[model samples]
Target: MKTQTAKEIADNLYTGVVSRFGCPRVLLSDRGQPFMSKIVKAMCEILQVTQHHTTSYHPNTNGTVERQNHTLAQSLRTYCNDTHDKWPSLIPGIMMAFRRSVCATTGFSPFYMLFGQEMKIPFDIALEPKDSLPQDTRVYIDQFLSNIKMSHKIALQNEAAQKEKDKVRHDQTARVRTFAIGDLVLLKVHKFPKGQSRKLCDKATGPYRIEEIGPNYTYGIRRISDHKKQASLVNATNLQPYIRPDPTRQRLSQEDQNIPPDPDSDSDSDPEVDQDDEVTPNVDVEATQQPTPTPQQTPDPATRYQIQKVLRGRRKHGRREMYIKWLDGSCTWEPDTCFDQEMSDFINSRWTKQGKRRKSYFN
Candidate 1:
């Protein structure tokens, strides 16, 4: 989207001195907005500078300038530790630092290459100012440039060494044993039931087969259930190698089968018994037994009265609750204000029951 016009890029590259220092014959840039602007194109034509542009959105074609921008930003960030937004104000410092520094690829400072002699600055001055001898500004400039060149060379060497060290470490491979489908494996069960713990050895309790490698990447493994026909999935970390079952042991049914049945001949004899015969004489038909009639008692009226009394007691208490609610809060009952005797007794009983239950729980 940023179309840099040849004139605009040239203007920024040279700052305010492009026309004063003599215009470049050919200006190479990208099809950014500043370059594609009609005004910039007209300006380039008027200045009689040839304009060249690379493919759209290809920063590598204008790599040198983009790399310079990146360096300036990085250096600017380092200088503006507390006030990074003020980086624009420090653009002059960044540009001077860049120019004074030697080029990594070409091994020459831009200032030295452009002027055929380097520019002088405050950082590299060594000798005191003199008046007797004719002052040579060129010596001061050379010393300043020489210091920057040494620093740049050292930085490049350190970068190359760090890259080599990283490459050596990064190239090493991590070991992994890939599990495939239908392979018998012992499941490394990491989690278990709430009351159960997994302190089993690496030789843990399984000879399960891999039902599936993975359904998707989120779940990495599939294991067949030991007690069912179903399968379960697991991650790589939860898996372990299968251990052989114990050879010296047998199932409970097998052990029971090895035992012999008890002998059936060991039995006790029955007890001895005696018997006798008895006779009875016949009776007359006229002597027959008579049936006795019993009287049934009627229900008592006092029982009915007791039932009505119980009902009357409950009704009286109900009226008292309603009267208390109206007197205290206009018939809207609340815990704080409705304090009838019946209600207080009921509340106290319930609190007592609740307290007993709480104590039972703790006990």
Candidate 2:
């Protein structure tokens, strides 16, 4: 098939897939132009179908499609004529063979799973002769319905077992990652066109904050600078934790730590020197002796809110809301317009703690 435009894709998905199988609860696709288009988004919204995009550069997130493509290619290579142009003609036969064969993931043929019976190929016809006499239509119908129910029950059980086994194998190499709502993250980029120097180009983008998390590790993210805007969905593997810098705190200099103590200071005086000449050392006098601890400033009681977190943006609601988690274990949803500059800065500070450095986006 020729490459389709976004509108074409949206129409095909609705008519070809949805019409046949009904609208799915969730639709998963890569971040392709067709999938990410406005029309597709509208279609999903209207259908109430949650759309999920796989992490860029991580094809394994859409492994089912990839695996099927591989299988199809192998089959075509094995059966196609020398010219290879005849491959398209062989598709129906190849699909039938595949449907009639046992699937490794389900332990059952697609025909059996769907229709609750084996496909009546020519081989089956040759083995068993059909009875011409028709009788007891009601009893035959009841028995057929019962067999279908039993077959479906068996298929479901087999599918569950196969899934557990697959999960065990998958988990062996899978790394667990944790992310909080409103946490800034970097997303991997892998869709650059051909012939560009990848080493020189940026491999990832964003410091996007998590707006919402959906099913299957998919997250809705918006630019950290513009959290008020709508966000895009990205899978978990593409996102990595981003630690926003705190400008309020100052870092101690290593050069100052290595400097020798001042010899002229009264604190450097020997035991033979008079006690009256000895001076009280200042806490900031790092070059003299061990630095004294600075007294902690008491925070103002009225302004002291222990915990603060930004939940998400108010893109579509018209009224902006910032959901916060407090230290008292209470969660409150507050209007963003209510926050002053100080409160806004305080919430942004929670994006990263003091002195913690974040990893590079590409890595």
Candidate 3:
């Protein structure tokens, strides 16, 4: 516990669980270096314990452990001396108190659930009467077994009810988002260089293309510029659709257009041109000059690309966007305003046939 080295962590795990309770069937932990290192893996293999890790950068997968850690930290802060050097020695007392405390989800203390009886604290021993144990070992074993079974059943029911309440609370603000393979997205930056100000640095940094879709809202992404894949799969919560800027708007803004000078303005007239030099025999020249053919209408560059299909839709920052698959087999996300009335109608018809709600853009 003094250091987070792989050997130390593995030693502590073996001493803590194997010595106290025995080898567990499964070990769930975050993707920390100490937990994922070869030393820990070897230990788990030797103990025949299956190891599972939470998703990268996602702490909610191990929410129960995280919450307990938070509680432990709060307790340490409250009870530790001003120097905080003795905080490590107080962990055992805090842990015991926690195990005896009733959990809101299970509605029963962990001690009672595990041992089939409430723990006898100093206060209870002094103030409350203790019940006598059964004389026969068989009778006591049957009672303990029955109590354990009944307590487990009730605790499971309470846990289920609590989970439903939590789900409902979460669903009130949760939005469903899905991504397909080849979709472009921005990956959130979880770490910055040491001494760099996080507030000034960019929060998200990628125009990464999704290479593969995985279970549990995860995706394997690669950088678009270099095609370099990420080392670990990224969760959906840390990615946003990458909307490419319109090239037409940028081109028009950058290029200067020629404008004819005002004929009536004094600035247009050449004061040095003499009236005698202006010959009036320009009628023949004017008659010979045929009317210039009207310039052909140039097609809009924005509409040149043909859309093959509308793959999906999502709302980001209050703006609705559709994932468009072009005829050339390329894909990108476009806003609702980008589509003309005819294109909007076509998209709506396709979506309606697929049993999706109608988009309100054209209407």
TM-scores for all candidates: the values are: 0.34, 0.60, 0.69
lDDT of 2 by residue, 40-109 (tens): 9999999999998876556877888999889999999999888888889889988888889998766678
Arrange candidates by lDDT, highest first: which order?
Answer: 3, 2, 1
Quick one: best lDDT, which candidate?
3
Model 1: per-residue Cα lDDT over 1-363, one tens digit each: 144555656566456646457777877876667766776677678888888775432355577789888987788777885845676778887788778787654456777666555667875455546468776899978876776767567656865876687567644432234577666566554356576555543334356666556532112333355344322345444455554466434234644445442232111121232213221332421122112112233333223222111111112212221112221223332331245443444334433422221121101
Top of the candidates by TM-score: 3
Error of 1 at 147 (Å): 18
Tens digits of per-residue lDDT, candidate 3, 1-363, equal 668999998988889889999999999998899998999999999999999888799898789999999999999999999998999899999999999999999989999999998998888889987668648889889999999999999999999999999998887556656899988899889999899999999999989999888878989999978889998788899998887876543433222343344454332365775646644556643443334222334443334546665667877555567877777889998876687754665566656533355654222
Q: Model 1 — which ten-residue stretch has the worst lDDT?
A: 306-315
Model 2 segments beyond 4 Å from truth? 6-63, 81-83, 130-136, 193-195, 225-230, 244-263, 266-363
Question: Which candidate would rank higher by TM-score, 1 or 3?
Answer: 3
- Greater lDDT among 1 and 2 belongs to 2
